[model samples]
Target: MISIPDEIGNLSGLITVELHLNDIEGSIPTRMKELMNLQQLDLRGNRLDCSISDEFCQLKNLGWLALSNNKIHGLVPTCLGNLTSLRYLDLGSNNLTSRLPSALWSLKDILELDLSSNALIGSIPPQIQNLRAITKLNPSRNKIAGNIPDRIGSLLSLQFLDLSLNFITGMIPKSMETLIDLRYLNVSHNKLRGEIPDGGLSKNLTGQSFMMNDALCGRNPSLQIQPCVNQISQQRSNLVEMHIAYTPRLNIMIDVTSGLEYLHEGYSSPIVHCDLKPSNVLLDEDMVAHVSDFGISKLLDSGQSKTKTKTLATIGYIAPEYDQKELCLQKEMFIALGLR
Candidate 1:
């Protein structure tokens, strides 16, 4: 602060400073730049404003910076790229805008970057791909738009990514599959379309990633988008087409016998696949998929059958009453939710 810069900067051996939760006023001190040994600084929740001094970037030893919830505005000083040892950066809830300094990616050791709730706009820079150590990134609630660079997946260490509440559009880059370490991802409420990687983060994420977009679908369980979601979403032909119609069709081999008429012949049941399982279904001589084992099938089942013919799936796939199957001895106890 301008009031105590002489006292605060006098401690040449000091490694950290916590001036948050105070009524500090005036521009940050030019003398505070004298803390050459400082490794951490937290000036959050202050009334600080004005473009940060270019000299602030002189603190090359600084490893962490948290100046969030301030009144700072104007482009983030490109000099920040000089903080090569930084591991954390949070500039959230500020008025900052303009093309983010490409130097930002210079912090190779950075683990978490939070620039959400700012006025930042423009395409997410391709230079961001250089940050290979990022573990969590929150760029939500901004004006960012344009195609998310295909290189975004290069952050193999990313554990959580939140790009929601923005104007971003275009198909999600397939390179995103490179993030095998991702546990939680939210690209919802954006314009990202296309299926996520089958072997990478896409496998661990869920339908939550592709929701709200007119044309986005993926293998992520949280984004349970149907084939139609991709059929209509043809933004980038360069990436692999992601549509439901291309669902894998398994090839089957079977043999037919005489005296056994076609089971579907004039059948009033219409033979909808309420429960499709290997035990309840089989392939005919014509190699056509069929449902046969109906030991625990439901009559009211039409669409996605919650209670299947058998206890074939795991917890998430089981019907609520299916757990009560322990009390009922019959093949069918309660009806599953579906069409009749």
Candidate 2:
């Protein structure tokens, strides 16, 4: 592991510093900004720590700067927006902190920007609408919060987007449904709520891509998501042939039975879905029922038939045998559902 010597800055005319894939330690030399002719600075896969200095923004001639896979920390210098010639910039997989600077939207020549796996906070600035040249933007696995900017759809050139594992909230911008060129998208594991947008690239996305969010609902049967109320209401409004819907009603019943079977005998250990009400049954476009809201479900491990717990079923759905304490069982859940 070599410490980059400060004396190298005296060379003055250096154009590129490709010291990546090394065990280089310690902070970058402050005087390295003297490399007036430097165009690319690739120091990826290194052990370099310390904050990125403002001097880096002084490299007016720089075009490609890749400093990923390092321990580099602190706020990204706002002056980075001044690098008009920059085309590609990657600072991913680092320990960098602070909110992203809105000034970044000014980099009209930038084609790709990756700042994922950092400790960045705050919402994506609305000024992102100006990044017309950006084709790929990854800010996933960060601490970013608030709604995804509604103007994100303005980036017509966007192809790849990953905003997973953040604290982002609110509905996905409706404008995103207009991104015809988008090929990949992942916004899972966040606090996003509302119906998943349909049409365009959204139809191509699957259940796995939007899992772990408790409130997200969609219409795609392949995605196995429960249809949102708006979608269900729309379907009902358009159901001119109500007499032909008997088959769909039977399908819902069969799906509920299948769900109960899974809970009773599917896993390595048996589970009892204690609460089985109409409200707890989610439906897809095909009217297939999906068991949901397992807030009070119980597990019966090996040698254990049933464990007693406080009664938690909805009124009128509760079995007479269930008193102050109840032993949640599959048969009881079925009986409760049958009564309703």
Candidate 3:
């Protein structure tokens, strides 16, 4: 069909058009947008290009729009933010580039939006928080970047969020652990670091899905992490050198406990690692803790700050106040303090 005759516009009460998969060619007739009452339009399997008409936004009652498998270019229209009545939109499989419109987040009634397989770049905007009503969003296969913003965890209504194959980075937000409704998430191939949350989409990822990012570590069986001990040891050594007081006690611990005490606690007597573990703390003849191991007494992270959390490596060695799943808990340090 070349499209309904212009005379059909006079009918004035049209709500739907079913013409689809008709092997149509060339640009979508601009006059088609004149059907103000048109609620649904299907122009799939076509050779459309440039971009969808901003005129489509005129269809306030329009609920579904499919412009996929086309040659659509340029950023999506900012006017889409005005489509408060739309429930579904597909602009995938195109040459779309740049960030999505900030206005599109206003589509509170939108249920599914697929802008996948495009050239979109830049960090996924946190302005997306306005999409409080979205259930599923697929922006996979884009050039988007930075860590998935923390606001994504606030999406209580999002059940599916696919941001795979992007350049997102930094550690995965600990807040994402609270997403109880997220059943599927694909943050693979990004620069996201740290462990994946225990439940939700992360729980299902094989190490393979989250592979290729050197910063990422997960409990998934598919991922195999190299020993991180060497890295931690190097950092610990740095802090030890900075620990000025320990430098004196390094060679001689005999009856040096009191001097070390003054050094670690300072003249004010601030308690360092008040919760020492069961292992015998490394102490000199005077009960002064050594700056190095065998006693595990020196604040391993011998930085200038005496009150910093003891860097531990054991799973539960961290302080009681910290949530293990969130934050960068130095469980290894916690364990070293306990073991000897």
Candidate 4:
């Protein structure tokens, strides 16, 4: 391995420096700022154990920068936001730490940004909504937490996004339901809960793209998730609210029962939703009530024939046999829906 010679920065009129795939080591010389006309700097696939130079931001004419597959560590310099002419950036496969600087979102001219495979922590700032010109963003394989920003859907030009293998929490933002241009998304292996939003860009992704988050539920059979309560509430809110006669109410009640039938008998294994109530019953776009809320549910395989321990259920809806033994699915659903 060889260390970059400091005197090499004397090339004042250098336009591009491609030293990738070498075994070069040591810090990137600070005098590199003298390359005022440099447009691209590719030092990837090296053993450089240097801090990413903050001085590189002074290369005002730079458009593409790739420093991946190095031993570079420490925080990404916020000064990078000053590279207004930059269009593509890749800093992946490094040992960089600390929260991503919100200032990086100010790169309005950037098209693709890759910061994956680092030790980055903290929440993705809402400032990302301002990157209206960006198309692809990959920040996977980090320690990021907090809810996904609601404004992510506002990036009309975004085509691909990957935030997998992080500590992200809370529901997938409802704002994401409007991402008309999103063709690819991966949010798996996080703490995200609630139902994956139906329709729009989300509908295009398969269950594999959203796996490992056990708290998540969805209406799509392909995802194998229990429908969420929030989806039901949204359906109810969209209704006309006219008073329905007894006959129409009966039909809604039957639909609710049929939903339970699928859970108890339609599947090879039976699923018992211990806490069934009106709030747990969600309606789809067609006003069909679907049983939901599997927070306290139990699964019964035909082979094991096991039952779950009793916890709490809604006051009026609790079954008599529930306190004595495992809940009986047929009786539990009837009592919960009958009173509603």
Candidate 5:
């Protein structure tokens, strides 16, 4: 491994330096700051094992900076925010050990920011809404704590968001439902609670998105959490009191069967709903029954027929073969019949 030579900085007219995915090691040469005309600097996927020097911040024209997947340590230089022209910044998969600098959020022109897989602390500040042009924001797998700012919905241009494997708390704001451009979201393994916002990006999500968060509840059965029982009961009571026509039993039956069919044969890999009972079936406003609670579900791989599990499904609903701790395609079919 070799370090960047100080003489390399003599190229003051240089506009780009893309020495990434190499064996480059040692601290970044401060002399590189003399490259005042530099617009992009990417040294990611290297052995650069030192703290970021503040001298690098002197490049006022820098627009794209990627230093991810390295051995870089120390606090992110707050002075880097002075580069108002920055359009992209990626510092993920490093040893950075400081709270996110508030100044970083001031990069209003930044389109993508990734600070994942570090030891960073501190809450996501409300000023994050300032990144109005941002399309991707990932800060997962960190020690970051505090509530997700409601103002996050203000980033209408956002398309992907990942906040998983963190110490965050509080409810996911309903405001997120308004982000029409959002296509992917992951907040799993956090302390999030309350009803998950419905519609929009949520409609395309699955159980994997909200996995391991025990407190969340919503009408999306694929979330695999318990339904909001009190809310459902109230809705039903109101319909009866208002003399509204309830959904026909035949319709409910059809909805349940359809849900089962999708889980069994719709995908390359079949998903087995281990528990198929009345409690796990939720009725929507239209009285449509959706299969919920996939906490004990199983997904079989290609060409795989049977699998075993130590976990048991509900007593009355468990297939006879499942009593021997084995699960096969017939297991779900048997339970579905029992539900009928």
Candidate 6:
């Protein structure tokens, strides 16, 4: 049908409506609320336009709804959360805007949720942990910011998660290490930082799953980021216990200086290693020290001598000028060596 007839609403006993992959070009009828027994509705891959009507929430028996790939705009009706029987929902590839309604997280029985490729803003709320039965969650390609809630690990049944192409910041929550059922994850193209957890699902993730996130470091070589700085400190302890002879102090000093020199002059733009400390200097089997941990490093523009940053380096090793919000590579080595 070219368009759903408003008279179809007269079928009050209808339990399901599937009009996907059609040329349907009109708005969802408000009279749809008359179908009290409707348990499922699928209208994806259509040319339908206009905002989702709040009347749909009147269908208390709605267990599944799919409206992706439409011209749907405006806020998702907050009352949809009243449908406790909703087990699946897809509103992706639309023009929906505004913050995600907090009420959506109340869907405790939701099995899959797809809200990707929209203009939605705001952070994922902590109440998200209520979706304990969720198996797949996709909110990628939106403007959502803030941390991935630490409680996300509580989704014991979660096997697929995608939060890519957003403005999300902060470390991937350590609690995610507990997601034993997770088989796929993607947090790429975001502003995430710190160490990526090294257990469970994370162990199986590849670099492709985290590409374009410059500050994320992990022990997984496939992730292609730097090794976590804490791992270097752990290695140092192991070496000391094994009675391995420490590299000469002079050699370490030279190696560190050489590394800094390269950072300052070896590239098109100068890089300032914000955190320099003994623990951040990693030693290979050959006792060769390699400078690591660029999680908070900054790259200055050509001819720029200093820049401002909110991320603080190691407290004791931070240069005095850093406190003023000015950042440069100057004197950090001395501070790292406790000479200041």
For candidate 5, list the clashing residue pairs, or say none: none
Q: Tell me which of candidates 4 and 5 scores higher on lDDT.
A: 5
Q: Give the root-mean-square deviation of each candidate in angstroms.
A: 17.3, 18.5, 15.4, 17.1, 21.5, 17.8
lDDT of 3 by residue, 1-340 (tens): 3433546556557787765566555666566666788777766656666666787777788888887877778777788878778888888888998576777777767888888999987676777777777889998888887767788777788887788888888877777776778777777777777666555656544565566667765544444543244556766877765664455643343323443355455744332333344343454444455443222233334443433333432444544544343323233334324322
How high is the lDDT of residue 296 in model 3?
24
Error of 3 at 68 (Å): 0.6
Score each candidate by Cα lDDT: 0.67, 0.85, 0.65, 0.83, 0.85, 0.87
Candidates ranked by TM-score: 6, 5, 2, 4, 1, 3
Task: Compute the lDDT for candidate 4.
Answer: 0.83
- The worst-scoring run of ten residues by lDDT in candidate 5 lies at 328-337
For model 2, residues 1-340, the per-residue Cα lDDT tens digits are 5889999789788888899999899999999899999998999999999788999999999999999999999999889999998989999999988788877889987999999999998889888987888999999999999998999989899999999999999988889988999988998899988877777857777777777778888877777777898889888877834634555666777888888898787887888877777788876665667999887788888666677778567556665546555577667777766734
In model 5, which runs have C-alpha deviations exceeding 4 angstroms? 232-340
Total residue pair clashes for candidate 6: 0
Per-residue lDDT over 1-340 for candidate 4, one digit per residue giving the tens place of the 0 to 100 score: 5977888788988898999998888879998888899999999999999788789889999999999999999999999998999999999999999788887899987999999999998898888987889999999999999989988878888888999999999988878877788889999999999878887855677887788998998877776666678767866755455433323777678887887778788878887777777778776757777787787777788754446565647655655546666544555666767643
Worst 10 residues of 6 by lDDT: 325-334
Q: Model 3 segments beyond 4 Å from truth?
A: 1-11, 199-201, 222-340
What global local distance difference test value does model 3 have?
A: 0.65
RMSD of candidate 6 to true structure, Å: 17.8
Which wins on lDDT, candidate 1 or candidate 3? 1
In model 4, which residue pairs have backbone atoms overlapping below 3 Å? 232-282
Better of 1 and 5 by lDDT: 5
Clashing pairs in 6: none
